[model samples]
Target: MHKPNQTKQATARGRGAGYNPDIRFDRVSRASFDDGWDMVEDLPVLRTQVREESAKTIISTNRSPDLSFDQSINPYRGCEHGCIYCFARPSHAFLGLSPGLDFETQLTVKPNAAMLLEKALRNPRYTPKTIAIGTNTDPYQPIEKTREIMREILGVLSDFNHPLAIVTKGTLIGRDIDLLAPMAAKGLLRVGISVTTLDPEVSRKLEPRVPNPAARLRVIRALSDAGIPVRVMISPVIPALTDHEVEAIVAAAKDAGAVAASSILLRLPREVAPLFRDWLATHYPDRAARIMNRVRELHGGKDYDPTFGKRMTGQGVWAELQHQRFKQASARYGLDRRLPPLRTDLFAVPPQAGDQMALF
Candidate 1:
């Protein structure tokens, strides 16, 4: 039997600027008029909860043809960045948690990630491939400053001369330029910074906790100055919203020292669809329906398309137009360049207790 649906009221402090419900769970929140609604207007502050996750393995392999890399590692399960349109949000439902506020408030960290990575790299049968980081969640999220799990994992990768790529919107990634710069010099690393919109107000409501667009651009410049390759990702381009800023974003990144640029059409999978809809309703009520309507037009009349090829770029007129815009922007801004691929041949396992020394 299905459980009874439960509802909770969202308070100013606990709810994001564009708060919404997680579609996976039966529990939801709504304004109650019985007590004049003011009774629930102000609630206690919501604190973040961090949990320890002892994962059996560190390396995760995926066969998705659309992905650039085959293996990846997520030091944290839930992101505190709190991007309302995060595609990774739906994955939180598998943990029996709400993909709404719970996803941002509750988090899990794998403290042993460095050791596990080292162990995996030591495997005799293991073959080297560029390991992707921050694919599911930002490795440099706020908590990383205290947890330092991402730093530890980077240490392991640096020691093994492992090739890796990172994608993030966190400014904290600058703290690890010491690790990344050297790896990049050896053709073993590349970084992608995701920037959604240039408007700080829009960013505040959309990806509330992430760094502002200007700060993200500074990160690209800093990384590029250190001889590290930077790829500006104008990601999850909302059709009726920030879509107009595509060329401007690419041009800005190019001016900021980004070597290359790319983009992904916004994806609203499963629980994310309703959550995103609610977000649009809260923040852009006037254009909410029109935006989703355009999204459906791109996704074959559905909220999203999970098919590999069409999922990233979508189909039809609008998608083609966006594709053409990106191509033109890249060409116009000289942003159509490729960074050297991360090198895998330099991988070497450090000597263990019983290992014999190599002859000089």
Candidate 2:
């Protein structure tokens, strides 16, 4: 890991904002200080490393009531889109890594994901259902351009005629228009594009390395123009910071041809809480305390509450006000009225060469 000097730390806003040592491993944490001296400084540049993971199974099943899908596939373990408030950051702790910088700089790629998915679909007991992608991390994150792992997974799904849903903040998904457009036509695919804020500066500091706000809107337009159903996700509606942009984001997505919309209140579960608080202090020091105070109110005077029902959208006045705003905006924009459901009937196991033909 590269260490930033005082000057670099002051100027480098997003790249190393939440860079912290692994608390689980380090007994003592060190901080750097600069003494006025004539010495050359080397600016720190974080490099990404991909460690291939050998996964036996690709499909992950969960019974969480708040979720829309029952199963999902994650092609990668860590995300390059360093969203400070991402709730998925804690997952990196299980791998003995820091949830701060390690969650963004160090990543694991499951190179055999496509093959494993094909094998899972071939199981006789496997049932057809909408398998979600990008639930844990964006499948189309920066490395996807070079790895092309996500593209291969989509190709496998297309071959097996598998129905799947995707939620991503990456613009790279636009590259797969040929695959997504056809699957959407067959009612096998639906996409949710997450737009945090329309403010370019806010997006840059909050979700470092993600596509710009304008670029994300362009993604919505492109996907929709290709005849793929697009849903705009205004997720993790940070109370005081970005809550005001609710209506504006909804209108923009609707104008771009997105048919539906959804949102989630900011969830600061575990390690993400401190990381997000640090981000608030760095970017918006003036309102950091007020923002966190409101967040606590939403989570019942705690940093977070994992209760499923109240998790996505919190409880009480603030939560209700946010929900009502979204409801009114969506209604005014004619979003989320009657979007088509992803079809599971189209799913079928690809026939092997030795497969016997059924007699009619």
Candidate 3:
């Protein structure tokens, strides 16, 4: 249901736009009403959606050494979190949809995720390894509250004693503490909350639907108090944007009981380039050009470069300085340390074919 903006949620253009499958517009705020008197406004445009049922799911596997784990699962395609700079936005283009606003509004849900995962695990040749969740789109992204796909998937992994990791910007993970807390006690689970900025105003503009920074910090404390390991991620350290808050954020998260921390540089890839540029122009018109110029300088004279070796952390004097600052700040707060590893040695095959008890 697309609710027309009342007062708080206005579009960037100060006018409502006609929907075109190919284009997306930045939103703006305005004071009063303007006249179009078109009946089309009353028409319920069935918001576009992407859906999936079941198949031998070929989840993406990558051998990136810098990451935490080798395997992961995505229960949904396209996230609803309207973060303007999300690097995952471009992925929607493969489904013949605009990566702009559609990347958030047009969502694809895999309803059979848990069943498929159980089948995959039951195969005799299947090996048990820690499989991460929320890597691409947040597993606990708003829709999961209703869809229950992530919850179901977690249930299956629990039954099999599989190790798991999750990274999210949402507060919903707190709802599953019953499952997560036990996993942590068994050395089978860990979660990292992404706290982008300390300012609520900055967080509202940057992450849109994501929980506010204070709320996310509360989640960190809640998880820690429950005995579930919590890590804080200061992600996409946009140089002049939120970069200065790194030390402050780490200090706060550490006080809230986060055990370790990590971060990444802003990633602008594929369609995210134009979207991010539009966001910068809308939110920080005065500093937009300067920010892009710095990014280009770091990329060896481009707005962005996709080279593997330096994609996550760009190479240049500026990049080096940012990396050094992060290292220093993390060490200062004692957040550079690592947490206990998730134990994969406890994994086991779940149930027997004739086991009615497996229904539990």
Candidate 4:
């Protein structure tokens, strides 16, 4: 007989912030355990990952007002950092996988990513535009250390003088100091480090495998000191949870050398909603209801509203309050303004080998 869908309503957020992911379906229940998940994984277990490739050399562009860039590239899918509240978790649904463990354990690495990018860049119709990385999945996540896929992509971008932006939570980026520093000198790059909370307990439970808040601040300092523009992203300002640190986090990043700063409210999209709910019920049972209640209030009295204009910043009293706090604190720290724009004028496509027809 086929196994039943045994894990109904997985939770994604308790150990983290609002990005927690858990799987749930029909007629499934979890095993009753006396101790919590923290007790269950005392010893480190080797994580599993799946690698794959796509046929395309390049991905097309779509317009989104919230995001700055039109085109993007992801060398890997499914981050291994295992942050429970990762919004990218639901992307696993496309492959008929659960957003819980499947998202962290089953990953895809594209070995030919740099080759394909170079090919696309050399295309006649290709125009140099800022290609966003680390938008969907972190390029510098744990697996990067071994795979080095992101490093290869950066090499290609540097060769062609392409403008790029990265958002990350790992310290692995420090390894790319050589590439990023020169790009920064040319005003061709920017980096954003997401700092969710200052409290260690909160950081451990929420982001689990990612770097600590202090470590992330060091990233800001290191990147900024190297001349790269650093933005402190106080992301997903979790109400009744992480919202308290909005000002303090900003203050810390500014003092550390960050030249700019921004914040985004928590977003619970599709499979993410149920997973986050399950996490709340499992971990913070007492405040679960209140947290969801506040999320709805910020999201216009609903779990989530997909309205394009309202998605990034949400709405209502709580959202407005979070925005106000960020605005005031950022202004005070001289981080209210946007960083200088990157230069795309340096981009150039080199000729392929034996294209003697051009010389003739």
Work out the TM-score per prediction: 0.92, 0.92, 0.86, 0.87
Across residues 223-342, which tens digit of lDDT does each residue of candidate 3 receive? 999998888989988868898998999999999999888988887887677667767876889999988888887777876888876778888999999889889988998889888778
lDDT of 1 at 245: 98
Residue 193, candidate 2: Cα error in Å is 0.3
The prediction achieving the highest TM-score against the true structure is 1
RMSD of each: 3.1, 3.0, 6.1, 4.9
- Candidate ranking under TM-score, highest first, comes to 1, 2, 4, 3
Alpha-carbon deviation at 69 in model 1, angstroms: 0.8
Report the alpha-carbon TM-score of model 4 versus the true structure.
0.87
Check candidate 3 and list the clashing pairs: 11-27, 11-28, 12-27, 12-28
| Worst lDDT 10-window in candidate 2 | 1-10
Give the per-residue lDDT digits (tens) of candidate 4, residues 1-360.
211222222242222323323344423333433344455333333346676866475554759787788998888878777666677877876665667666776788888898999988988898888988988888898889988989999998988899999999989999998998998888789998989999887777667778899999998899888888899998878878899898899999998999889999888887677767766775678898999998998788887887888987988877887889899999999999877678889998765677755543
TM-score, structure 2 vs. true = 0.92
**Which runs of model 3 end up more than 4 angstroms from their true locations?**
1-52, 353-360
Clashing pairs in 1: none
Q: Which regions of candidate 1 fall more than 4 Å away from where they truly are?
A: 1-42, 352-360
